[model samples]
Target: MAFRPLGRRAYGSIPHLPGSRTGPADRHLSPALARTLTQRARDARDHVVVLEKLDGSCVAAARVGDSLLALGREGQLAAHSANEARRLWATWVARHAERFLAVLRPGERVVGEWLALAHGTRYALPHEPFVAFDLMRDEARSPWREVTERLGNAGFVLPGLVHEGAPLAVEAVMERLGGAGFHGALDPVEGAVWRLERRDAQGVRVELLAKYVRPDKVDGSLLPENSGRPAHWNWRPEAPPPPPEMS
Candidate 1:
């Protein structure tokens, strides 16, 4: 069965910029607009919240009508009990999740990483599973503080909060991360997502976000430089010439 749709795009994605992309598959856009977006991000580097990009399968627990269903990216099922996370949420966190369900307004959902045995063990976890660095309230994201507080109240493991209150170079932030993973080990963290909160003097609000895929780990699975389109097909930036200026 289907559940609520996810966020339109990740932070710093080409569409996050001022202009726009034709579609997810092609993702064609003007180079000048792309550069402008990057420039704006650079200018707003003073205030940002960075969270460790957990390297695991994406999983979610959404309120599907009367049932709370666990899902993978693209609404894929977790292979019955075969999926470690399915069990983790369907059974382990099942009871605790009720507290969350009590408040959820039906269409809302929570998404997080499902660190199971499938992806190499960086945490050396003893038992069941883990879900952190989540997306709560359907497509809407809860701030770092609210996420932590809510998860803590529900007995879920807290995700890492590497940097806060500044916009810094991806390299600098990666250096600080230095092979850190969920349990604080000197291993690959994949990279980090910068969640910038911007507020104007007139009380207007905006947010600039981006995902910086680690240079060392440029798997198409998660790339800051690349992304999939509407058809969920991944695409790479090639050496083709640009379309004539948008006049």
Candidate 2:
């Protein structure tokens, strides 16, 4: 049987996030998730985690049966994508197939940012190109603590940890992230992501993710297609040095 990777859902923007372009379906948080956020605001130690929001294409490596497949955000097999970045992601996955297969169970997928191609925030990466943020098996995500340990143990780089307590105002989160994030983003840090988990009525855990993007952020400001220049890669193995400038 062929593998069927699940598509990652678009994360909703926190209500206070400025200049968010979220559609109607993604603008509102579920009542339970909202309560979690509210509780976090009252207590500094509510179950909330904040991480540096990376600006890169969302991709995943899924171990299906005996094969590992590279997938785009929509769960399409990336090897067949027309986009060069997605194709490159497939090659990266193949190169690291052994690690992915070793760490993933039959139906699990490691979803993360593929930073090989610059998007809004380009990086001078301090680690491998792919920064795994979540371990999912369909719609459910592993809890934050487990996610950190699992992905870290599996030798995957993770997004910079920003905060883990009360929800901070956007300005505060940016201040903590500073001009360049831990990954060495050349431009302004785009924003931060908030993740919270709570048990449902059936006692099944539900994970929620919300984001706060900078109000002035311009999507894809650095891509070749948008910038009309040669591509700037965040990670290119054996990348050649740039030519000397003419006087």
Candidate 3:
């Protein structure tokens, strides 16, 4: 699997939007307030798709020769660091690697979330611990339907789809996350991830894939917690830079 790239913060503003504010970190916005409000680039779509933005470690798994290698955003972690979720994922990948290889072209990676023990529990999941989010081919994104169907057919639980229609405003999507899933079932979901489904001569790729997190029901830090044990290398979740922070 290929490493994930960063999505420079979504420069446009949405009222009450809590974007990627991190270490030194993504803390404040921009060098100056005026620049953030006027200069940052923002994307707006007529139709928006929002999936449950899960709280877990970013996982990338692939089939290498005869072994199934599980990786974090940074690099491969040892058996102990990988946790149960990742080990289970590696097994799943081993079982279905050939099935996925048959369909994927070249340079495509299966991006997902490993939720064995990251943040405290938020959702009621009793199925496979890891959930597939997207199929990435270099910088381009594949359509959501294609990614989920392929994995779902393999008897896996795909990420929950919240909204898939004309322009669900960012604020509204955030509002719904606090309550239930699409079917009105009470689920303590983290937040919603928004992406535009656009097709071109090349094919379908996820565009402006962005996230909106709920402070009340989500982990404040993006990184997974550690056991306070020291290691030679630290593990960090790899992701495209957050959409340019909306001023």
- Looking at model 2, residue 158 earns an lDDT score of 90
Q: Return whichever of 2 and 3 wins on TM-score.
A: 2
- Give Cα-based local distance difference scores for all models: 0.50, 0.75, 0.51
Candidate 3 lDDT for residue 225: 52
Once fitted onto the true fold, the runs of candidate 3 whose alpha carbons sit more than 4 angstroms away are 1-23, 27-47, 64-67, 77-88, 95-106, 178-187, 217-247
Question: Cα miss at 57, model 3 (Å)?
Answer: 1.2
Q: Write the per-residue lDDT of candidate 1 for residues 43-146, one digit (tens) a residue.
A: 54335677677655566666656666655556644434444334444443355567557544576566666654234224454323455565455455665666
Q: Candidate 3: TM-score?
A: 0.62
Candidate 3 C-alpha lDDT tens digits along 44-128: 3233566876666677654334444455655453132425445555555555677667655554666777664445334445555
What would the per-residue lDDT of candidate 2 be over residues 1-247, giving only the tens digit for each residue? Answer: 3233554432212443444445455464554555565343434334677799899999888877998988887777787766777878888898889988888889888889899989888788888889898888866677777777777887889999988756555566789999898898999888888786554555424356777777688888888789998888888767333332445
Spell out the clash pairs found in candidate 1: 11-209, 11-210, 12-209, 12-210, 24-229, 24-230, 25-229, 45-167, 48-166, 179-187
Kindly report which residue stretches of model 1 are placed more than 4 angstroms away from their true locations once superposed.
Answer: 1-47, 64-66, 77-89, 93-96, 102-105, 118-121, 126-128, 200-208, 218-247
Q: Which is the leading candidate under TM-score?
A: 2
Q: What is the lDDT of residue 151 in candidate 2?
A: 78
Model 2 clash tally?
Answer: 0
